[model samples]
Target: MQKQADRVVQILKSKGLRVTPQRFAVYANLLERLDHPTADQILNDLNQDAPTSSQATVYLSLQTLRDAGLVREVLLEQGVCRYDANVEPHHHFRCRCCGKIEDIEWDAFEGLSFRKLRAGLKVDSYEITVNGVCDRCQH
Candidate 1:
């Protein structure tokens, strides 16, 4: 766990961001859990070990991490915002029945392109979220 924390710190430093203990804790927690937690959920978990961690700190840290390209914000139905630590080029599979979000392998969309869909619009990044009942929920 310490090694992972150290690597996170190094990554933050490389991104020219300050390496605060609060930030480290936040990042580590995100790394530990890939369930895509909301800011409130993250704050609640952080307060378990760090009572001094305020909501503002977590929010700021998330924003900073997002700015540094270390995390991504996922918006689900009803405008729920969740934080995802995986910054790779992939999509997500959302289980509507249980609100579970899982990573979709990049190879699923390999060699797929949509640049020709529009003429004058420059496409940046795109996210494809498949929503349905997961296998566990189906069973």
Candidate 2:
């Protein structure tokens, strides 16, 4: 809707990035989907709405959004990248049976001690991806 587009524009402008129609459309698509989507998937959905974007534009928009810390990358498989709109601290769970990814509450691992690591390896930020059959798949 117009609200989503305006919100995307606000965030992009706050980050001092150029707001192109293609970029806004791509970002709007990302915001609407909870599923971590790849650039190709985003493009396909965008094509359904407006079929004027190239794959490269999607990729560039994703890169820009990630660089601005508005989106996060979910790299579970080699050469297969997914995009997450939830930039807040959290982990991920991947359903092996369905290849679905869901966010895990970051507080669940609150007590994890990074001090247990070997010397000189400073810990910054990390994301844990739990792979297993999800609840729906277990049925």
Candidate 3:
């Protein structure tokens, strides 16, 4: 946990972002739980240590982190937005029943190409989310 916190601090510093307690706590929480939690979920978890931490603070912290490219937003069903700390080039797998989100390694689709599919449009980046029953939900 300490290592992860330190890494978060370093990332924030590298991005020229102030390393505040709230931001550290938020980033650390996301690192600890790669489940892709929502802002409310993150706030609920943070309240254990920082009862005064407001939803707006978490939201802002998340926005800053996202802008710094340290975090990515995952939009699942019903316009719900979840935050993911893994910024590496990768995809996602969402459990249909439990709505659990897990990382799908980049290598899984390394050979994929869409140059022909996106002939005219300028492609910046892309993310794919596969929905299915996870292992726990399968059983």
The per-model lDDT (C-alpha) reads 0.86, 0.86, 0.87
| Candidate no. 3 TM-score | 0.85
**Lowest summed lDDT window (length 10), candidate 3:** 110-119
Error of 1 at 129 (Å): 0.3
Q: Work out the TM-score per prediction.
A: 0.86, 0.89, 0.85
lDDT per residue for candidate 3 within 1-139, as digits (tens), equals 7777777778778988898988888888898897899999999999976497899999999999898877888887687899998888888999999988889987787677776775688778888888999999888
lDDT of 1 by residue, 3-114 (tens): 8777777788898888898888788889989799999999999888648888999999999888877788988667788998898977889998988889997778768787
Cand. 2 Cα-lDDT:
0.86
Off by over 4 Å in 1: 110-116
- Candidate 2 structure quality by residue, lDDT tens digits, 1-139: 7886777778888989988988877777888898899999999998986589899999999998888777888898779999988889989989999998888998877677888899999988888888899999988
On a 0 to 100 scale, what is the lDDT of residue 135 in model 2? 92
